[model samples]
Target: MLKLLYNKKASAALANLSVGGRLPHAILFEGPQGCGKKLAADIAAQYALCEGEQKPCGVCSQCVKVERHTHPDLRYFTVPAGKKEFPIDLVRQLRQEAYIAPNEGCCKVYVIDQAHAMNASAQNALLKIIEEPPAHARFILLCENRSMMLPTILSRVTAIELELPTVEQCAQALASLRPQNSPEERQAAASGAGGNIGRALSLLETGKPARAMADAKKLCELLIFADRYQPLEILAGYDKDREGLLAMLPLLKGMFAQIAVSHYAKTGRDERVCNRVTPAQALDAAQAVEAAVRQAGQNVNIPLLCALMVERAKQALH
Candidate 1:
């Protein structure tokens, strides 16, 4: 069984198949970063390789092997670190290996991370095996978004979308994962990460992301309630911190996005910003933040970039 606190829809869909004992030959788990796609893929692989009567009884040897990544029949693949995309050569090799018999069991489970990073050629090569997979083979693809996948590949697999949990749920989850941390610390991390478990964990491990998010939220509040000069004070703080600026820009953009749609939807902590800023102004601010992110990546002068971002955000209010 898949043990997950959030993404109930995805868990249920995969759980239903575990009961039939005939899982999909190819399945894709799609969600944003920190949304538990990898965890779901591992659970699905366990379900395929388990020998227990109830399917993926997690205490069984087969399940333990999968957890330890020592199972001979379970294969894992991902793009080489520092590389932009999966090479066609690796995909061809994977396709060839899909036909080989399982080493330790009747079923072979292959879990591929960052499947969306495969280029057209690599995706086409992968399409061959998924199109006509061996009877004993099962493939699990993990990606942030399904839109990056080729249409042909998308048609061949079952795609499950994993949703992020709410802030309270994320805080509750952190209690179990990081028992040493105080409840207040966990709640702060969860709020800073906007309910992303992976991001919250990263924030807890290193205070940088949490610091960036805190500054970003303060800037948003200033932009909404105070004069333009007050926000510049916050922006100038990031002038010498490139990494912090890079981290904070996306969060600022995301907050603006939430503000833009808050009139029609629920946006949790951004309700104050939504009430103060109109949807049009919020959207323009989001675009300005996006431009600042691009400029930061291009080696722009950090101080000049920060000043320009503040100016643009001020203009967005008009």
Candidate 2:
């Protein structure tokens, strides 16, 4: 499985567990959204079920069943569609299911994606089972942040933080997935994706490398100008492509940070591309941009927020 591509730290952790036979009953995989935490959990589950010394023997029945999601002992839990929280009912059902002995594998694996989305009551219900899980049951709690979870929950399980793969690794993996693409195209997509493999594949599939790069360049230019007209243009463009705008937030933020640091180094004082301003001024501009980003996440009118951000940027520049 692609889990073999896990970063060195995560791979070493798993290897240590396998060799020492000291795998925890519950493991929390915390990382950025597309960093392959779920894949690693699945690999660990397969290892737990493998009949041979090496795990995830693709030919083995257990491995096949786990991959197919038909394994009686392997249970998967995720937030319901369109819902922001994991319902207590799901936790109760899982509690009942956990008691059942493994049907076809040596261990029963339960994978909870977005575990932080569980409400307080749901978390409490889960805490009970986690504190005293069945001998054959194993839990994988996948979260983007540990702070979102209860302190009690955080204390029980082992935590594994997944880091984004290197650009070369991301490019190689993307190439393997899209063998039809030219090497240059694959490389461009990988670099544009900014270490996100899923995004890299999406960009490749949709042939959006040129558009993404163009958008990034334009955004940088707008920041450099720090003018009134450009913010309106950016806002209009963002309104026309909300998804793309949202996807580019982190990239824009990174660029601004780089500009801030470079300006500081060059001038011996904090300045960003937006203006020859103090560090605090640049930070204010960044924060304003971040607020606009948060508004976009709330489904606010992108154009309106963009306009507001542009006005703020103009003020900061002056």
After superposition, which runs of candidate 2 have C-alpha atoms over 4 Å from their true positions? Answer: 20-22, 56-58, 210-318
RMSD of each: 8.7, 8.9
In terms of lDDT, model 2 sits at 0.74
Q: How close is candidate 1 to the true structure, as a TM-score?
A: 0.67
Clashing pairs in 2: none
TM-scores for every candidate against the unseen true structure: 0.67, 0.65
Best prediction by TM-score = 1
Worst 10 residues of 1 by lDDT: 266-275
- The local distance difference test score of model 1 is 0.83
- lDDT for each residue of candidate 2 in 84-179, tens digit (9 for 90 to 100): 998899999999999999887888999999998998899999999999999999999999889999999999998888988765688798777788
List candidate 1 stretches off by more than 4 Å: 208-318
**lDDT for position 210 in model 2:** 47
Candidate 1 per-residue C-alpha lDDT over 1-318 given as tens digits, one digit per residue, 9 for 90 to 100: 347788889988999877788789999999989998878987998889888888778888888888888999999889988998978888888888888999887699989899999998889989999999999999999988899999999999999899999877998999998988766567667755767899889878877666777787898878767787888887788777665676677778877887887778743545555657899999998999889888986889987887788788888976
